[model samples]
Target: MQRTPEPELMDAPEQASAYAAADFSAGDQALIERIQALFPSGLGPRVLDLGCGPGNISFRLARADSAAEVIGLDGAPAMLQLAQQSLEKEPALAKRLSFVCLCLPSLALPKGCSGLVSNSLLHHLHDPLVLWQAIAQAAAPGARVYVKDLRRPPSPEVAEQLRQRYLADAPAVLQHDYLASLHAAFTAAEVEQQLHRCGLDQLQVAEVDDRYLEIWGQLP
Candidate 1:
């Protein structure tokens, strides 16, 4: 299926609310576990969570390592608001975790990041290269990189089947966004090409499970 790009940011009040309300603990926890397993040594002392919608993984990343400082960046203020609200409830994470309102292709991207992880941000970008370049601009020597996002199915029918199988009971807005994201997602081959263009040969891209692709490695 040809990729149909969705809006880059989930900034709408209703849309952000639905995402905040959803119980995605299982998938979020799985991602944290994957990161820990892949980089068992640690994510270094500082980490950046790109496109951190509501601080879901950001909180976990900060909690996973007491010494690690985590920064969650998102383009959407609505989502950031939710993240801030959640942050207020956890005073312990106040000093270690914080959210920033920022988007890709920006010169203000924090430089020399020890680690960078993004979840579901690639598919939304109009130019996929923006992400790869951002990774290069922000990462320090030997920075760890991990990115995971939905993978476009071979056909729209398959996309719908996966959506129904996993998100059948989700809210209408969530369902709409999920399907749109799937349609906008890139395949593993396309991601490999993007990496090649960015000279990011060190990072490895592979299909994970039924409908997702993950890229991970230590930056050279």
Candidate 2:
């Protein structure tokens, strides 16, 4: 499937709410586990979660390391609002985790981060280089980076097939978004080219699952 760009931010309340309500436990948990493995111990004392919609992975990162402070950055105010509400529910997490409303490629990071992670965010970008540039700017020396996103299927028929197989039970809105995302997603080879173009060839890009691709490694 050729790349089709979606909105860069999930700023609409209805869209954000539907996405927040969607059940992504299996994949989310798998991503958390992989990130944990990257550090073995933890992601150091500070972490940055780019495009952290509703703070799912940010909270997990905080929990993975009791001492780590996590900053969840997103361009969507509605999504950040949901994340803040979630933070309020977990008083302990509130201290170690916080959400910031910031768009990517700005290069004005909240702080020099020790680690960075992003989930399902790359496909939304109109220009892939924005993400790579942000990553290079935000990361500290030797910061661990992990990014996971849907891999564009070989054809639209395959995308629809995967959607029916995996998200058949989801709400119509969620299902629509999933299909759009799949169409917008990059193939593993495309991601490799993006990484190389961004001068981040050291990062490893691999197809981690039938529908997902992962890029992970440390900053040079």
Candidate 3:
């Protein structure tokens, strides 16, 4: 597939709106379910959700495993605030999940985290190697990492498939997400190459769909 143009960083307002407008359709939800099935219960893992706008993935992780300690990190303050608001209504989940405002490329992680999960964030990175380094440094040895993101070109056929099969009734937020994700995604093969270039050879990256790729592996 042909590569799409690299995405430019959205400013604060745009970032906030984009996040607000973000929605995970059935396909995205299925991907998350697959991620959830990977973890065993009662392990009480420490998980990090990078670029966790509105804490969607963070909240989902907490819901998937109440015993896990989930931390959400995002660069935009507004997005963080929205996450906080959502947390307000789910006190049980709110206690287990926390949000931090920091760019993934430079943020420090608490030691001994068991896992790391990021969705729709890698494409926004100007230097993914920096963030990958952070993921490597933060996770404990043998810790697991799962990332779901777009693969480029979002062929007209695939877009139409997504629309007809899953997005026909999608909300505006999701529609925007679908389009933006296309522009922001890269091919699975390309992402795998990048992981090796970043010295993340331990990572295993694979494509899950025409628009979605899952990159994961246990840290060395």
Top model by lDDT, which number? 1
Roughly what TM-score does model 2 have, to 2 decimal places?
Answer: 0.96
List, residue by residue over 82-159, the lDDT tens digit for candidate 2: 999999999988888999898877857866788989998999999988888888888888889999999999999999
Q: After superposition on all CA atoms, what RMSD does each candidate show versus the true structure? A: 0.7, 1.1, 3.2
Number of clashes found in candidate 2 = 0
Candidate 1 lDDT, 1-220, residue by residue in tens: 9999999999999999999999999999999999999999989988999999999999999999999999999999999999999999999999999999998899999888999999999999999999999989999999999999999999999999999999999999999999999999999999999999999988999998999999999987
Candidate 2, which segments miss by more than 4 Å at Cα? Answer: none
Please, what are the lDDT tens digits per residue for candidate 3 over residues 1-220? 4544444333366656665665655545675677767654422479888778787778877887867899998777778888898899898786689998877566466667888888878877766666678788778877888888776654766755665575667666556556666755677777877888878887877777555778877777
Which candidate comes out best when scored by TM-score?
1
lDDT of each: 0.95, 0.88, 0.72
Output the better candidate (1/2) by lDDT: 1
Q: Clash number for every model?
A: 0, 0, 0
lDDT of 1: 0.95
Q: After superposing candidate 3 on the true structure, give the runs of residues whose Cα lies further than 4 Å from its correct spot.
A: 1-29, 41-44, 154-177
TM-scores for all candidates? 0.99, 0.96, 0.80
Query: Would you list the clashing residue pairs of candidate 2?
Result: none
